[model samples]
Structures are given as C-alpha cells and as structure tokens.
Target: MGAMSHPHHPGELAAPDPVRLLAVRDTPLSLDEVFAAVGDDAAGGTALFVGTVRDHDGGADVAGLGYSAHPSAEAELRRVAQKVVDDFPVRALAAVHRVGELAVGDLAVVVAVSCPHRAEAFAACRRLIDDLKSEVPIWKHQNFADGTEEWVGA
Candidate 1:
C-alpha cells in the first residue's frame, strides 16, 4: 500500500509516514507482512525483530503460552510505534503483536523499521519492541509441563 496522506496547511509539506503498520490480532503474526510494510525506496537498511514462544522460561519448562490483550492494546501499540518514529530518523516502520493461544516456537510479535542507515534502523526497531512490551496492555498465560500455569507481563 502507498503511504497514507494527511491534510496539511499551506506552506507545509505532507507529514512523513509515521508508522506503516500497527496491529494486535488474535491470529498468528507475520514477519513478512511487517517487513513489507516498511519497504521504502529511500531506506538503505531495514531491521526486523521476531519474538517467539520458547520452550522454557526462568528455568521452568514451558509447554505453551496464551496471549491476551486489553481493549486498549491496539491503540497502545500505535502510540508506541509513533513514539519510535518521532524519536528516530525512521523512513518507515511496522509492528504487530499476536494474541490467542500459541505453541512453542510460534511467533508472539514481529516488528520492523527502515531507515537511511543500519544503526538507526536497528535502534528504532529495538525501541519499538521494548516500548511495546513495556507499554502495551498484553498479558501472557504460560502453561508449564509440570501441570502448573502462570501469568506474566499482566
């Protein structure tokens, strides 16, 4: 899709593309989709981050995890993405967090940032995921192999 255009007053250029994509969905997340959203001719580098469910956490055997998001989660994601764009020299950006049950190795989140250089792209991508994890209202319910369950990042 083309970059969205916003209304601008006279003598003002159009606003730069802030975030190419931002979403919270119950279905599995896709790295390709996120990467494609940030594809820009002006960008010399693109950084991508994919977070997946691991088999273990804190030395405990994790069987799987179920992600749940508050009603404001999507909005919070957009807020976080926009912050990264504003703080960095980002040409384009995208972020998606997955909800619903997921097995081990399944993707939990995917984020991408494109910039004029590798350093900025990497920094912006890192900031996007870090802020999203810290600010977004998402919880993880982990199922352990030992027949126990725990809630994390609530």
Candidate 2:
C-alpha cells in the first residue's frame, strides 16, 4: 500500500527492511512517545512485548530487585536495537529496560516491533529481548521473600 510495499511479494508479506529504533527506561514509559518516532502509515502490523518484574524466579519468591547499568547503556541499547531491526527487517522497533531499585511486578523491560506482517514482529520481539539480556550493560539485583538480596549478572 505504501512505497515500501513489494508488488510481487504476497499480500500478507512484509518488506524486509526496517527504519528506526526507540528504546528507553521502563519506568512510566509512554507507548505513544516511543512509537511516535517510529510509526509509518505504510506499516500494517505492530507487535509489542512488555517484560514485567515477576514475583518469583527459579522458585525464589522475589520481593524486589535492583538494577544498575553503565552510563552509556541507553546509547548502546539503541545501537543494538537498531542493528537487530536492520538485520531482521524490522519495520519499527522499541526497547525499554529499567534501572535502579524496583519492586516485584514493576516493569523490567519492554520491546515493540512493527512490520508489514506478524511474523517479523514476533521474531524481532524475541530477538530484541534475547539480545538485550546478552548484550546490554544493564544488570539486576534480586531480593527474595526471606530478605536475602543478591546482585545478578553484575
């Protein structure tokens, strides 16, 4: 429908090139704010993933968690997010991961991927989170119900 559409590609198929990356902290994020920068009328599909701080992990009752990150974390996150979009044909991408002290059920991270089809959105979302966990400088500290706390991936 838009200039990005492929004439020969299936009607449901999406173009294999993405344009932007929007990433930030998880606290009180504005979905409208992040996607506003990346939205394209040409895009028909938008996929979003929100990672929340759960109450438990590995059978541990997590009461709270703390996270710390390098000062350059956001910049690096942007770079990596964009790279994933470029490598995967993501139409629009966003990633938000929080730092500092956080309570259980607080949002830990958020990632959104938009493309011409649902598959790219799903794929990109998965990869975005996977890459973030592996590559981003952000770290987490876990607090258990027993008042035990430990730094994770420091």
Candidate 3:
C-alpha cells in the first residue's frame, strides 16, 4: 500500500492510530499489557516481536549494556507504530521499549501487531520492529571487561 501523508498536527505530526506505546525501566515487561493493546474483535491474526539483548555483538566479548532515550522517544515510537497501523491493515498495535541498565538476554523492545489477515499482521510486525530500530531515539550501551562502554543508536 502507498504511504499516505498524515495531515500534520500542530507541534507534532498526526497520530491516527496508537493502541499503546511506552518507555519503561529496564525490566521484564508485562505480556498482558502487550496482549491487551493488540487485541481486537475483528483481528484474526496477531504477530509479536520481542527484541532481546544478546551476550555478544559483532564478536565483542561484552559483559552487559545500558539504554538511554531522549525525552521524546516514547512519542516518536508511538508515531512510528501508528504509521504502520495506518499504512497497513492493522487492527491494533503496541510498542514498548526498555531503558536503563540491562543485563544479557534481557528484553529490549516488544512490538505486537494484529490484523484481519496473517500476512498483513506478519508484515506489519516486521516493519514495526525494523523501523523502531532505525528511527527510534533509544540507545544501547555495551560494556566490556576493560571497563569501557560504547553507546550505539537503536
């Protein structure tokens, strides 16, 4: 589907659809929250994407990491998720991002998208995660044994 231009809103862009969006502390989030936001009577297919921190990255022997976000990160994340919903046939959607100190194998982000069709739901779910990683203001900090840290964009 072609990307439609969302009418601009004063002080921000238009947000036509956002079942849920949040930025929370680095901890295990409630799966119930995700399910609630992406649940709808009309949806027959639901897709979920959970992004986790791995023990290593690019062959780096990293110990752990942290994530920081600008104050407007949550709003931006909402916008992105909403856009996916608007562009596709998504019936409901939810995006949650974790910040602060994190350990290996922790959940970093979770994106759930539901739609009437399985293909659209799957496609929208992938797009939601890819765009979140590329466009969101969230950052990742990688720590090594040498006490060095590196901050990278999400």
Local distance difference test, each candidate? 0.87, 0.72, 0.77
| lDDT over C-alpha atoms for residue 42 of model 2 | 57
Worst 10 residues of 2 by lDDT: 10-19
Point out where model 3 deviates above 4 Å: 1-18, 24-27
Expressed as tens digits, the lDDT of each residue in 7-106 for candidate 1 is 8432132128748788889898887788889888777788999999999988999999999999999999888888887888888888888999999999
58-105 per-residue lDDT for model 2 (tens digits): 898999888888888887887778777666655567777777788877
Number of the candidate with higher lDDT, 2 or 3 = 3
List TM-scores for all candidates, in order: 0.89, 0.79, 0.81
Q: Which ten residues in a row have the lowest lDDT in candidate 3?
A: 8-17
lDDT of 3 by residue, 1-154 (tens): 9966767322132124546545555567666788788887677788998887787777677788888988888888877876796688777788888888878888888889887778888998999999988888888889976677777874
Model 1 clash count equals 0
**TM-score order of candidates, best first?**
1, 3, 2
At residue 17, give the lDDT of candidate 3: 56
Which clashing pairs does model 3 show? Answer: none
lDDT of 3: 0.77
Identify the candidate with maximal TM-score: 1
